[model samples]
Target chain A: MSSQIFSPGLQQALDLVGIFVFALSGGLLAVRKNMDIFGICVLAEATALGGGVMRDLVIGATPVAAFSDLGYFSTPLAAGLVVFFLHPQVERINTAVQTLDAAGLGLFCVAGTIKAHDYGLGFVPSVALGMLTAAGGGVVRDLLALEPPALLRWDREIYAVPALVGSTVVAALIAGNRLTPLNAGAAALSAFAIRMLALRYGWRAPRAWHRNDSRTSEE
Target chain B: MSSQIFSPGLQQALDLVGIFVFALSGGLLAVRKNMDIFGICVLAEATALGGGVMRDLVIGATPVAAFSDLGYFSTPLAAGLVVFFLHPQVERINTAVQTLDAAGLGLFCVAGTIKAHDYGLGFVPSVALGMLTAAGGGVVRDLLALEPPALLRWDREIYAVPALVGSTVVAALIAGNRLTPLNAGAAALSAFAIRMLALRYGWRAPRAWHRNDSRTSEE
Candidate 1:
């Protein structure tokens, strides 16, 4: 079951890459906030691991990933060190961080959906958990940074939508018993494509009507 | 079962107070961050409801508190209004805020543990969930404010520890079938006393060796 659920080598590689990219973004935010080195490391670790930890606990998985995996714990620390030494270089390549962040989102969403399915949830719940898995870290990051959640903002480019799409595709594949490498590939591609398209087009969820009407009511 | 857990009137009152206090803190933080009224309201709702929402989902309780009760949703809005108009007065009484926050912590810890136990977890797991329930909203709040989590700080007066103590007492009571009103009173008093003592005496968790060692290594 473990072999079928995850390719250990591929999963490890993906975890490392995801951790690094997420940590980079989190570290950058810390710098913007004028936090000390320790603060930067904490933010980075939270950004990289918070969502998955939450996901694992909710699903009754014991000894969460950050606790069990040295690499997962250390990757954020390493990223924090790099940011500490290379702030100028990182600031100059901020756009690159955003791109990598998009990639991390894609990977986490797919991985999250797959993991949820492995834990024996139905399709609907699997999709919901997958969406949470993908967006949860970023949400936590935003909260710690005192920013409105990117997911809650109408101005931000699509975030949760891509995760939703990815999870739905994976759920469909699993439901059909076609959970092959190709299915996994398709899920990742769909998520990435949706995210990139949202970025390019500056797409956002429509605000509920009361959102605007109530603002005027307040004034 | 509901009657055994709480008299309907007491439950309603506690829920109202919890929502009001939680939302007030969230809204005040948003105001301090210079968010617009809508943003303040959104955050207020999130802060007041986030922990309960998470607890409900984990326990497979559908139609979470915020969704099912408009009063739950509106409590934050009311708190937002109070913060909007009474900012200076509230700021002047920061001590009161802290006291109220401690009370909230105690209530949430006990309530959360009872709910978790009701959902069929063993003693230890129930205590863990109770701590999470008490601390999770604040963690979320700090994260949004882009501040390092207060709970993770080395010098934050005892916060999570009090919740842990509270949860332990409650779990012990429930497990031993000694969950009488008197026991409940004792648990709440103990929690409140420990938290207040921590505040008064500036009690802190003993710093792990790794904390100082890590700082030295970084230096």
Candidate 2:
């Protein structure tokens, strides 16, 4: 595949937006960790692009996107700049960051699925890669922040499940030869709505049997 | 295609040995991070099996080995127990730890390549996965420890390169219908020797021009 196809202007725009939100999330986590600016930026970059880079390499794409595209590499840098200069103001708007992050989760799920499909992966693998691409960065971010993985933590809202749903819808649509812009929009909407509902209603997966055993016995 | 083939008694033995060394390295890193017992165990498990788990999932192997094998999962717990009680004694044998770590790297590279080949990947991708399986865990460990990744640091020895060489040799032998226990032994020895030499001699790749222009230089 031509790098040009991967660099369509619209995709670039979406990637930059995703990076900004991802970096903001990372910065917020770093603040919770009381990290310096360097830590914040490193975490931000890892959160924004770590998944995509891993996906690209696994699919045998040479010169991973993070290394090949200056714009892609610099998106987190811009976000880091914002965090460095406006952290105090940013801290007051955590809700807005969460909303944008939800949007990023939706966008990345679609983009990652498409990328995996382009590499000729089967639908199941594409959906799996999509979820990984959407959630892998957050996993790294939380690990670096020394928090339990957000996907594994009891307090996390519906995150990976929504991304999985979105990717599944997209994969099914693509397989059916109905992957038009409208279908993509619907898939993204489904993911965004699920995440928003989870946030607003505090939706969460039921913990496995073992998870509660320790807590209930402690109490 | 048989899970039994992959989970053979010999593979289990190799995995146990690799996990022990990897867990030791991870525990050492946790000591540097000042983590508690739980944190040390978490890091140790992540370090010992994270790379292999990643390689398996990428290759579409379900029920990741680390999760499926009670012995594999318990290895890190055993290591954690040792660290909790014998950290001072372990700390005094830094050289021994390094040697064991080299052995683990060799085992991981071979096992990763063999698994990837079983999944029907081409030679190049198998080699790449092997290198990733050898190095990816330590990269995650360093990220969690808030240290520069050993693979990315300027002080890098022949860490990835040795894995690449070993995996390539294994793949080539398999392709040529010359693979045997002796060939496997030769490949592992080659990888371990190169890694030890690099460690002793401080070998590293040349940086690309302008590579240090990024934030990594600030370190």
Candidate 3:
């Protein structure tokens, strides 16, 4: 399995970091919603592992990594505990959290595309799955929290675009027989840079054409 | 594949019916949310097929039944179209829709359990997957539409209970070596009856132990 992507140690370590950051986001959302501890844990787990589980399921990987790997399961619980005890402090470190989140998004998109490619998918579908693997967890968190999905909302920064870029970069690397760790790191970095730039500048997707007219004409 | 549970014809026909019904509910929700035709189709597909895909993934089934079968892929689009053109007339027949929804729930729970069991899972996990199969789509629909999931809310008349009952009934039938079509039908009928009665009597799950006090204390 490690040979399919990164070495075992490298893959596991990065995955754990990504899962931890995503779980923190979910736990914070639960706090804002005034949910109980159980809700907080559930939301954290969903946000941390939901996207990976979704990709595994789509690719027919049984017992998904979230369930089979103990670290993956426990990291979110630990994150939830941290949030429950020290949310105000956690809230103050927003910049740090966003930085970690961008890294996670970049890693997930590149890794997800490679995995899907390994599973015999074409490049186009692999790139699509890569975006899903990055953004899906946030979507799951918002859905469970009864909030609009940030990826689909106009107010949010361009989330999917960064993932798409990272995935496309991976796909190009694979096609060119240049999928070394160094190149992959650069691809991930590009994604991270794009996301940070989007966040810094308040970049957002445009709403549909004739948005108000569509609603009014129907009424 | 047919031998996994129902006869091929019976399975296909019943599955199509369930997919169509679930899609109708999803499409109606998208329409209510004032989504465009594309959104309506996406919601319909997710609501109809999301649960089964989740189950298939957990159970290690690849190319899932939804993607493998053309009928499964197209039925939701057809339902979305129906809702788009005839929602007012469909809305008028609330009782009919409710009855179909109950039937779909019943069918899904039983079939999902048997499929999981056939995949070599224990009864406990199979039953859980069964409930996931039946109720998971609606959960997806609500989550995507940004509504509080009805199954998890106390105000809703016990959605998961019916699915649990149906799956448990199937599990018991399997244990007793009486899992024929007739027995499975009876099991489904029991779930349908419970749901219809629950709707009539307004049964609800209890809230957490502390409830408002828990929140107030924290605040």
| Cα shift from native, residue A184, model 3 (Å) | 2.1
Task: Report the lDDT tens digits of candidate 1 across residue range A119-142.
Answer: 665676667667767777777777
Rank ordering of all candidates by lDDT, starting from the highest: 3, 2, 1
Model 2: chain B TM-score relative to the native chain B? 0.92
Q: For every model shown, what is its TM-score relative to the native structure?
A: 0.59, 0.57, 0.61
- Candidates 1 onward: DockQ, in order: 0.08, 0.04, 0.14
- Ranked by DockQ, top first: 3, 1, 2
Highest lDDT: give the candidate number: 3
Q: lDDT per residue, candidate 1, B80-164, as tens digits? A: 7777677567657877877777777777788888888888889998898888777787777666655577788877898888888
Overlapping backbone residue pairs in candidate 1 total 11
Candidate 1 Cα errors over 4 Å, as ranges = A1-6, A213-219, B1-49, B52-219
lDDT of 3 at A188: 84
**Candidate 3 pairs with clashing backbones:** none
Candidate 2's iRMSD: 11.4
User: CA lDDT of A114 in candidate 1?
Assistant: 75
CAPRI tier of model 1:
incorrect
